[model samples]
Target: MIVNLGDQLFMQLQLRGTIWTQTITNLRTNWAVNFSIDLLGQSQNYLYFRIEQYGSTFVDDAVYLNSKWKFARPSNQGCTLAFRGIKDFVSTPQLSADGLSCSVVKIIQRAKENPRPGF
Candidate 1:
């Protein structure tokens, strides 16, 4: 389902219990973004993302994380988005693996007129 992110922006996510995947493509551009999170087995809580442009792999700048939308560098091999915070993940909602959360990927300072996305 299309999880509306306010007005123009939205995300499509699929979750099967502890494992999930998401794909977000830019309709106006050739950018295709894909991400997956595995919260089970050895790859537990591992978050990864890949980007493609014009059907070709493209490695650009850092991805957004943190509350202020800070930049987090990707791997040098390609646009491999990896989170390096599993070592410090406590059983709490205050900490984020990639300085990001499922509820609020991009924090908004202003009020949203649109309703929040739900299951």
Candidate 2:
């Protein structure tokens, strides 16, 4: 499948009063198949992501807390996930007006440049 120039995707999980968010942007679908991910929640300092591609499943895990975060993978299937973190005081907030929680934020998935062929 060809993802075109600027496509987006995401996986979200609501767990125990907390929501885990992940997003992919600027996606290129060349050499890819069956791409999806699920947030298995966090443990200690590690955020676990379960990724499924081409019938194979694995984890893209990272150790991060109270900081900006991003994750990307390129293979027969490719993915890019990002978090804007906290905006500076002088800068306008993207997700919320009051501010954002380091633990929980919003996740969005959309086709920025082009949508899939068949509506």
Candidate 3:
């Protein structure tokens, strides 16, 4: 027997609710998935993302840290994660150089392993 349009719409809503419930539950159980990423595209429009997970976090943010000017105090006024590595390519746009660990993966990894930078 053919069902009424209202019944079909209700069934669709039920299916959607089930999917939404599962998604919310998964997100709550997994802290790794409950975060955001900000991609900072460099000059020349070169896309050089690690194309992989950075630590336990899902998406990675592009932060530029300097070997000399390390120690970024994000708690300071006007300081934030966005400015962790701000001075790198802001003054002059240039292609990311692997020699200086300009990739997103390296920057994030460095943050996790701050003390033992040589490691």
lDDT of 2 at 76: 20
lDDT value for candidate 2?
0.28
TM-score of 2: 0.20
lDDT per residue, candidate 1, 2-118, as tens digits? 222322323466666666676765544535577888867333333333222345322322232231112233222221222323222212113234544432233221122221211
Question: What are the per-residue Cα lDDT tens digits for candidate 3 across 26-54?
Answer: 22233222222233332121212121333
Worst 10 residues of 3 by lDDT: 8-17
Q: What lDDT would each prediction earn against the true structure? A: 0.35, 0.28, 0.24
Measured by TM-score, the strongest candidate is 1
Model 2, poorest ten-residue lDDT window? 110-119
Error of 1 at 53 (Å): 23
Which digits, one per residue and each the tens of the lDDT, describe model 2 over residues 33-91? 34333445543233433223455332322112122232222122111223322321111
lDDT of 3 at 97: 30
What are the TM-scores, per candidate, against the unseen true structure?
Answer: 0.27, 0.20, 0.14
Candidate 1: segments with Cα more than 4 A from true spot: 1-8, 41-119
